[model samples]
Target: MTIRLAAVAAPFGRDLDECFATIERLAFRARSEGASVLALPEACLGGYLANLGGEAAGPPALRRDGPELARLAGIAGDMVICAGYCEAEGDLRFNSVVCVTGDGILGHHRKVHQPLRENQSYAAGDGFTAFDTPAGRMGMMICYDKAFPESARSLALDGAQIVVCVSAWPASRTDPAPDLADDRWTRRFDLFDQARALENQVVWVSSNQSGTFGDLRFVGRAKIVGPGGEILAATGVSAGVAVASLDLEETLATARRSMGHLRDRRPEAYAAGF
Candidate 1:
């Protein structure tokens, strides 16, 4: 089915009320633009860590069944939304993403890979899985998890037609690029988004935090990528929503018809662990 998809690049901070307000506003705008699915940035609910290390305070840990998530579902209504937050399971906290609508939760994923000192803040997830949503069979990952090929591939293997990656990625701290466009990290972010989609032959939606938080300056380049890795719509280095409309089945079929990546996989040949 052809549906409009949107990925948002916006700032979110510690205030719970402010975060909800931002979500409500973004949801309204996406609905007005005919978007059936929306992807919001990682840690968009309670905010990301000020810095990756040195005992910086982390975002609030919320439960999967918390009232905050219920409020998010109410805002989602009919439209499907994938949002990231710090999840609390007893005393263990995880960096997690949840897909929801008015009917309630559709899917959830905790980040499987930790970058830098991120592991200090939250625990890693076990594996990847896809679940049904109004948009399609969708999968979710948070930030650094997308850097691993296996993460997206596992989701694809599970029959996910669409994958949403939410990130709190930042520009380089040491060798600061005066222009964010020239930042190598920004290039990596875009490259990973494209490469993951191309490799999996699945529609990819990428959302990231914008502006600055504490010591980090986020690279805001939210985008919607087609199955062939072509960028359908992107917000560039700004805070906005990148929206695009296309038939999911048709696009996937066209991309896979000649040489399907999934169909051609030689899983048994690569068992040596290079």
Candidate 2:
């Protein structure tokens, strides 16, 4: 079945109300364009902690069934939303993503990788798994999670046809690029999106924060990738939505037919610790 996918690279800042408003606005725009699944950047609910310390950087840790998520689900309506937020479980906090519809959450994932002092505020996720959604078998990943190949590979092994990665990824920490589009981080983001899709023969959705937050400047390169590693649509260093339509099953079938990367896997060739 052909379905439209969208990724929002717009910044929502740290205001909860404003974040919600932005989500609704962008979601409406996506729906108007016929996007069924919309991927918003990590921390889109309340923005991300740029330079704040543990205590000062608390980005509203919402529970999976909390009112905040319920509200998000309400706005989600028929469109499936895959977005990142800070998850609160008891007294612990996690950088997490939830795939939701009007019914509720379809799947939830906590980020497994921690860069810098992110661990100071959020606990890392344990594993990667895929779940059935209206869009297809889908999986979730956060910013740093995509840096590791095993993360997406695990989801693909679990029968995921589409993988959504929401990120608040910043530009080069030290040397700022004269042109945001030419930034190294921007290149890395695009490379990861393509590599992950091609390697697993799965559709890839990557969303990131655009503009500046604190001392960090985001490289808004939100994109949608086909199973064959083609960039179907992209938002380059701008706060906007990228949308593309594809025959979900047909694309995957054609990509895997010639080079069945998953089916021809040689798991025995590598050691677990490698």
Alpha carbon RMSD to native, model 2: 1.2
* TM-score, per-candidate, Cα-based: 0.98, 0.97
Model 1, range 151-222, lDDT digits (tens) per residue? Answer: 999899999999999999999998879999789999999999999999999999999999999999999999
Query: Model 2, residue 30: what's the lDDT?
Result: 94
Q: Best by lDDT, which number?
A: 1
Evaluate model 2: give its lDDT: 0.91
lDDT of every predicted structure (CA atoms) = 0.94, 0.91
Please report how far candidate 2 places residue 41 from its true position, in Å: 0.8
TM-score of model 1 (CA atoms) = 0.98
Best of the candidates, TM-score: 1
Give the poorly placed runs of model 2, Cα more than 4 Å off.
52-55
